[model samples]
Target: MKDEKIVGSFQLMKSLNKSLILNTIRTHGSISRSDIAKETKLTPPTVTNIVNELLEEGLVKEWQTGSSSGGRKPILLKINSSNFYVFGIDISPREIRFAITDLNAQTLLYKTITMKEEMTSSRLFQMIAKQLYIMMDEACIELKKFVGIGIGIHGRIDADEGSSGFAPQLQHRNVPLKKELEKEFRLPVKIENDVRAMAIGENWFGSGVGISNLVCIKISHGVGAGFILNKKLFHGTNGLAGEIGHMFIESSGLKCSCGNDGCLEALVGSEGIKQRTLNKISLGYKTKLIERTNGMIENVNGQLIYEAALEGDLLAKDILEETGRYLGIAIMNIIHLFNPERIIIGGGLAKAKNFILTPIQEVVEQRALTEQAKKTEIVLSKLGDQATVIGAVALVLNEMFSVQYESVS
Candidate 1:
């Protein structure tokens, strides 16, 4: 009985030790074995054993040592970023962007596909596969070297079934994107909401790198958000925790795409901005916009409206003023509820920094409880368009830490 107990304890300790080594290397790249041991609270011999196993699997590599103190210089060890590549695709209503990246989230190649507003899911999937094939061919990547594919659709993703739950942009419901692709590529597959993917990218390598409670809000094509609470991606029970777009602010307001009235996204999405501006222009709202750009609806985005406001376009300025005011109302709600540390704005429309952010900051300060509003900071996403792709890569890398998340090959 004592021998049996001892053997079981040994196995448990070995497994725990292996996890520590892997996690240490993941957080601190190019760390010496000694440093890893110190950080992971592992014996040097145990770390060496795990490191050797990982090296044999091509997951870790020993780098030439940099300068050290007078004592013997330690050989630097790092995760082999080139051991395999990951494919990430962001499929939107107007465009599908595909990128191939190494394990460390460095882009190797990228391609884009443009389509009409009302397109079918089947055709879109085929186009995506074709584009991905071309990108891989251009990059000269062998099929075996690619570990798997990750797709970021601009909707809620049920990754367990590899389906897009309610992607209004795709005009399809419950499309099993990853499952179908897995059959064709013969590799593992994962799908995520684009907003959540952006948050993942930030969590790994961007502004949210060290922060715990944060929000990544994107306001292009539509307004969506992803949340990081206590350093973990908090997906509510239905994977819809961060679906703050439909948070009701106006009960008698215009009908939203989600069949709701007065959603935050309904007020602030690109469509809303476009419609509001055109309505004002049609109603003889005078502004320098006509003289400035010669009456071009083509030139009017949320940012253009901000610029027009700055350039003395009364109509454009009014749009921003109202937009900022509404945004603040929504932010006040978030502050009271989440009490987060930071709210990082991303997406195409966040370009109107001052016009959008100032109002939001003001509203939060005025409306929200003082202490709650003080905790959050509204800012921009540094990764920009790269966030979704980088986040997809981060998703795959994180799976290694999960005991149940399996590999493809």
Candidate 2:
């Protein structure tokens, strides 16, 4: 039950034939050995060998018999989803969330730690390690049961290095997340941008399931996007492919954290929405928001505006509608550029979907080039607040199920 022994056993399961057979069983829910061999194009003996190894390792199990073609029924195999576990971490500007999930990405234990203030990289690392230890002890799961650790963090990420290039909210640079965590836990570690992780998570377990090309937009204190192109997470050169928040939308609009004017995030991100509401208030346009925030303009925020809009407050509704229009413009541009099958919106602002979704649809309808493009699906995230954290878990599951070595013909 030593950590190395566990790691070694997991590593042994990474053979190309093993991954192919395992994924086949996972995908089919339960599949016969002959069917797996046919589906994976592996020889019957190869499939039998790997499946037997998987069963012995407890990664998969033989289920009830499947219908046969006149002969005896064949025993089917399926993933032993609960046999191994993964750790997922979601790091945002204001908080860090931790989750333990089975192989299916179903959360088992979850916890959150709020940040009163920003801390150094070392401090952040210590907090994460301590909390993970507490969670492991609390869950009482054996150390050998853990397969890997995954982290989804904001800002630029050097995934190959498993380090953060710059976490703007945390004000930390070059934080060695993968290196530190793998050293501390003696388990494999994966890291990705928070938004990209959400996209992957959605593709695997949420709304984007079965969609080949998709985009997931997170609109909170800041805006960001994750892109899935051709059924794969597309990380552009320098891993900045989905930084749509900084995408230029207007030259004369408000400033963004990236120190740019009129970026998509500046127009519709939570701060931008709040600032626009405050600007409207400053212009002598009156509404219940003044009293709702107790005449303290600084207390005004996206959620309060949404609540006010729900109550038929014209000013609040108008602000959200305009914000939606801004988001729609950005999404339309995304459609023109990537032409994804669907775009999923998540985060704090998505709660105002009632108000914003209409405007967004309207803008796309009015401006998109082709009729098909105009009808592109735009929906809110099914995973909601847990999207990023679940995506963190997907980072590990993805690795676990993927065929690492290319198969020889």
* Best candidate (score: lDDT): 2
lDDT per residue for candidate 2 within 181-262, as digits (tens), equals: 7778878877877888899899889989889899999999778898888777887765667778888887756998667899
* Model 1 whole-model lDDT (C-alpha atoms): 0.72
Q: List per-prediction Cα lDDT, in the order shown.
A: 0.72, 0.83
**TM-score of predicted structure 1:** 0.84
Q: Where is the poorest 10-residue window by lDDT in model 1?
A: 1-10
Structural similarity to truth (TM-score) of each candidate: 0.84, 0.92
lDDT of 2 at 273: 88
Q: How many clashing residue pairs appear in each of the predictions shown?
A: 0, 0
- Cα error, candidate 2, residue 233 (Å): 0.8
